[model samples]
Structures are given as structure tokens and as C-alpha cells.
Target: MTFLTLLLQTPAAGGGFLQFLFPVAIGLVLYFFMIRPQQRKTAEAKSFRESLVKGTRVVTIGGLHGLLVEVGPETVLLEVERGQRLRFDRNAVARVAGNPAAEGATPTPNA
Candidate 1:
């Protein structure tokens, strides 16, 4: 009878350490896989936005492609067509088109 009580109590005692570590291991995994990469992406996007200037072509998040004709603190004037223009919030811009040095380079398709 005493041996049976001792054997059962040993497994319960071992589980206490695993229970304490489970949340910690989950937190570390989340920080590495989710939180850190998102922060890096946000910083890169912010820097790209701050570097905008006139005469640069850009694509908006909504898939609009245009040349930047004018820029303001809160808005940008875009020439989407030969004679048409549109206005959008600065943050709506997605990525700037590459400069002349990159014009001839072809992008490799992703696997």
C-alpha cells in the first residue's frame, strides 16, 4: 500500500516543473516568431515613407500606381494617368519605384 502511494506521488511531483515552464516556453516562441519580425517590418515601412520625394513613382496599398507630383505632411498628389491626378494619405503609399539604376534589372520570380 505504501509503495503504491509513493509511485503515484512521484509523477505528480514531476509534472509541477513542466507546468511552470510551459507558459514561459510559449512566450519565447511567440516573441521570436511573431513579435520581432512584425516590429522590423513596421520600421522598414516607416523609413520608406519618410524618404518619399517628388518625381518618384510609387504604388499604393490599394494597387494604384502613379508618379508623385506633390507631397504634403498629410497627403500626396499622384498622377495615375497621363492627364488625371488623385490624392491619398501619405501612409497609403506602399512602395516607391526603383530609381534609374534599377530600371533594367529584372526581378526573379519567387519559388
Candidate 2:
């Protein structure tokens, strides 16, 4: 009928506008929920790498745990075992396990 056709025509432009907004809304949601968090974590990791110091205990991205013997501009010297050392990029360090400032941050359970 003519009335049905007229109603459908009017809704088409409005539906198109909604469709245009959808991808934009998805982009924003992805940015906030996924992209923003990753950026912040990367910033944190970079700062931690820059602040690394000798004599600190750290874990690497490859699961090697060691004492930081030297902190270079782009590399670190780690003592992984008795009389054995290894070299790695600064970014290879994942988290500091024995930072003096982070020590005692959590209370140990009394057994």
C-alpha cells in the first residue's frame, strides 16, 4: 500500500544515520576498553625498564629470574645462577620482584 511505502521511505534515512554511528561507537568503545588500557600498560612497562637498577631482582618476559647486575642504556646484565650471567634487552624485563620500594608492600601471612 502507499502508506506502507511512505513509512518505509522515511525510516531509511534514519536507519542509515544509525548505521553510520555504529562503527564510530564501536571504535570508541574499543579505544576505551581495549586500546587505552594497552597504551597505559605499555607506558608503565617502559618507565619500569628505564628505572631499572643494579642489584634488583627481576623476572624476564621469557620467565628467567635473576638479580640485575648492571643496567645499561639498552641492555641489562643479569646473574641467573651462581657464577653464571646473561645479557638481555631492557624491555625483556617484565616485573621487578625485589625492588626496595616495593618490598614490604604486602604483609606475609603468619603460618
Among all candidates shown, the one with the greatest TM-score: 1
Q: Candidate 1's residue-wise lDDT over 1-111, tens digit each?
A: 999988888754457789989999999999999999999999999888888999999999999888999998889999987769999999999998667476568876871
Candidate 2, 1-111: lDDT as tens digits: 999988888744457778899999999999999999999998988888888999989999999888999999999999987858999999899997765565558856972
Task: Give each model's whole-structure lDDT.
Answer: 0.89, 0.88
TM-score of 1: 0.73
The superposed Cα distance between candidate 2 and the true structure at residue 62, in angstroms, equals 2.1
Q: Which segments of candidate 1 are over 4 A away from where they belong? A: 1-11, 98-111
List runs of model 2 lying over 4 Å from the truth.
Answer: 1-16, 98-111
Cα lDDT over the full model 1: 0.89
Clashes of each: 0, 0
Backbone clash pairs for candidate 1 read none
